[model samples]
Target: MALPEDMLHFVWKYRLYCTQGLHTDSGKSVVVLETGIHNHDAGPDFVAARIRIDGTEWVGNVEIHVNSSDWNKHGHQYDRAYNNVVLHVVYEHDGVITRQDGTVPETLELKSLIPVHVLSRYEELMRGLHWIPCERLIRTVPTLNRSQWLSRLLIERFEHRVTAIFDLLTRQRGNWEETCYIWLARSFGFKVNAQAFEQLARSLPQVVLGKYKGRAMAIEALFFGQAGMLENVVFNDTYPRELQREYRYLRKLHGLSPMDVSAWKYMRTRPGNFPTLRIAQFAALCLRSTRLFSAIIDTEAVNALKNWFEDLPIASYWYEHYRFDGVARPHSVQLGKRSIDMLLINTIAGILFAYGKYIGNETYIYRAITLLENLKAEDNAIIRRFSALGVQAGQAAESQALLQMKTYYCDKRKCLDCGMGLQLIKKQ
Candidate 1:
């Protein structure tokens, strides 16, 4: 009997097929080493691997399937990438296949050996419900194992974020620090103002900011200039007007054109998080700290770095207003404790990966792992939902999965590919 589709993933995940020795349709013995379900973005669906084939030990990358016909279904015969596939292992036997090189690839069928209970359990997990799928089963899984799983998942999560960083670095011609600075500033603006901040960074340029380093006025000019907020508006408030004048002079000095303030949107934002205030807050940090990136890099103590960020606040003017002309508010636009903690985690993790790649500093890698473990998990809406499902996210791994679900699967509407979806389908 054909295995249920819900259990297919479990079978694939655990590589359960190899318990039976590898045998081709002709009954010739084929020595098996390992097998992996293809997980690449653009490739064949599965790989049946072996230690050796025809006297060549460690023959790599064999394609596999549930039946011989799926090879044609997935259109692998025409794709050259599948040419390296040495053996074809299927669950059902029916066809003869030849590679472009004229070597007839060996095929094996695996229909009888897989356990039924495994499939049933997977089906149970995948069943849809009024609330969360596998709600009861998640609680039965050991917390320690869950934590380890999350740790691995969180590292993978960071790698996903790093891919974007790599793209930014490439755009900046491989200046890691500059790219880091721009990304930090963009993140500070959050999703609402990210594009504006990016435009600001591109307009003013980090090199210009370096020239005005340690001076809040120069920093503000660069920020406002790039934001396109320092146009010909005549404001009576001495600070706003003075900054505009300063930006005008600086724009001329740098031979730069004026930016369109229309590009810097502030609709629907709370005054506290308005782009103007956030930019000013970033400018203040740039002025207050020289060697900011270096300080983060050299700090062995996570608490010390956390304390530094906690103590810093926005400029006095920003403490009173969310916009250029908003009524004064009592609170300062400083980074929150939770936000600071996130920054520390991300920065430390990023530096750890960089140090590992550049200087072979495994210590930084270990430190990054330790810091993530010590920190409390972020409590966001998605995490809260997972908690309602009885999958409490108290550590990095669960949080990572939650984040991955939110960013990738949920946003992309690819629920079919998600573990949660698989669990729900199995439950049914």
Candidate 2:
């Protein structure tokens, strides 16, 4: 917020600088022919700009700063890319500035040119405290503007997910399948026992799972054993004892250590969301899925893919019990539409988006967004609060974007960088 250079960039981009009275530090009149397209990439701030300084048309680049000396502070004086700069724009002309070739570029001091009200409004937006800095004014922003900003937010969230998945991929030595399995397991656990599920997934290697994936019973044993849920339990049921026996054999064969059962939290959690059942469901999915990531990528429609997962059979034991000795769930233990949507949104669709980014394919990205757009908006505190503010999400796409905006932008008081803040600040 303290960087007047950002405000200067905005001013220069929009020609908000006082056109009627503009001059360089050397008392030469100035006129901007075109601000040029702002360079969002590394090189210059603005490229191919047409500016007239002292009756000379210089078509090149533009660089801005709070003071003239920042050209050297940022090592732009040593960079060849700055050699073509036509004008050095600054808020205060503290010192004379030069290009890499040692020629002084024409300097435009923006301090007296920008409207005071604009800067004041920007400062106020940056300093405010509320659910969001612009909560009071956000609803007033034009719909088209909000739509464009939400698209950017969605892309931001996509990039964040892609980066994280890449990190997981790297940790597994560039194994995409293992990363997908681990990520899927974490998503299956949701917010309650995500870490424990992830630990279980990591502890059991893909090779061992591949060896037993054809058998649902063995898959369940591997998952439950690594989760540390089958330790020292004397069960009267034949199936539970079979799982304990299978786990004992697999634990010895794989040379694997079980995770602490204490790590799996069940306090106040729903019976349907119990770790025991979730692992069983997860094992079922792994048993049926071959090339799970590719299948998700190739699957075009949401419901078709959803039905594929819904077809996974919940083991009979899960139907009879929520835990090793728990009472039976009266209802079938099949994953509901809500649970499926959560997995699709947080895992399957998310992986598609990440894979699309990794492979530089727009098809997968389009599929991911379409799936999200078709789903119901997630019913959560964030989505509800956004709805109360008159910024309702029509689908999961907007809700996901809103969640990102609230977490990474609003909560951090980054209103100065938000579109809503920009719109309100520039309002007359």
Candidate 3:
């Protein structure tokens, strides 16, 4: 395994070098004045650093490496971005380097500067087979730091979701309603056939559904027909024939094409999660609300929206059968409470977060935060694993943070970059 350069960057960034005699490879008198701002984007590791070299102050960027030869290995010698680097900081000075303009900057090696304990802790973390390397040490981190890290993790997850929504919004020409429709349709698929459901939405845009708004039959016809459901089944019930006829007329009138019905997953699926019922339940929501997505985004108080999705009435035909010719289940097809929560967490929260971020409005973000905080924490494998290690998630917000932490940090074994890893390894 390669030694991560981030460790060297960290050491260089915090001025962890031995201060008794700090000088460049060229043997110049050097004194640290100020370390530059750490830059995450393109260009340098740190910018605007002020350093006194040979009793003269110089200001520019700072680059870091595990070995001086990495400077050439990374082609920084030819890159113009390195021209402004005032210093080349490395762990070992194996080779010499110069700027693109044929000038040499000062070099400081951390081979004698870095402490032993940090390296020991880092190696220990890399050897772990535990759920997380810091699982045993997580509880010792101060409550305030842990809380702040979790908050930051949750925001990271939220921002990731927002970026995805913005990509869809851009493809849809900034149409929020269509993006919401596509998002909700995918959520309704519940992760199994989400792609198929999204294709269904794109095949029949929300504007098509808008033309048939408040007309339950027309909505059903368009939704089912575009789903490739109405054309294949022969039903004894009057509703199917009516839908078939209506869809045939509208399909030709609007030049509509239905998706392949085989795209939906059915084997081993629960009765409640049948695609027919989900589509009907979603269509019912469309019929009930004049503008479903808009109504959700415009709401101010979280209380009014708590039970908003509970009582959606699926079409009567859905109650009798899960498929077109399948035997009746003898039970009503109504949306479940968990399904409502799924919508809130996946669709509503995602859309509101995106809208807030896109326009720089904090109100929608606040509403999204409140809604998630009110809900119970998710009970998946990741959450259960974190819970087993004595980290309790009291709300969806914390659960989201745990997921981000586990996926992004623990799995990657970037303990060197984590707060827990820092506190656990720091010499006291």
Best by lDDT: 2
Better of 2 and 3 by lDDT: 2
Overlapping backbone residue pairs in candidate 3 total: 0
**Cα lDDT tens digits for candidate 1, 255-313:** 88756888766788776677887788678766666445566677777687676666454
Quick one: how many clashes does candidate 1 have? 19
TM-score versus the correct structure, for each prediction: 0.78, 0.86, 0.89
Candidates sorted on lDDT, descending: 2, 3, 1
Model 2 misplaced regions, further than 4 Å: 1-3, 36-48, 59-61, 67-85, 93-105, 173-175, 328-332
Return whichever of 1 and 3 wins on lDDT: 3
Clashes of each: 19, 0, 0
TM-score of 3: 0.89
lDDT of 2 at 287: 83
The C-alpha local distance difference test score for the whole of candidate 2 amounts to 0.84
- Cα shift from native, residue 247, model 3 (Å): 2.1
After superposition on all C-alphas, the RMSD of every candidate to the true structure, in Å, is 4.9, 3.3, 2.8
**lDDT, candidate 3, 1-428, per-residue tens:** 23478876766666655665788888887787888998888888999999888889999988988889888888988999999998888888887888899998789877876677767666677787687988777877887877888888888889989888999999999888888888888988988878888988899877777888678899888988999988667877788789999999999999999998888888788887888888887788777764667888877565566556667756777777887767775886876666777678778887888898888999888878878888788878988888888788999888988888898999898876776676676644
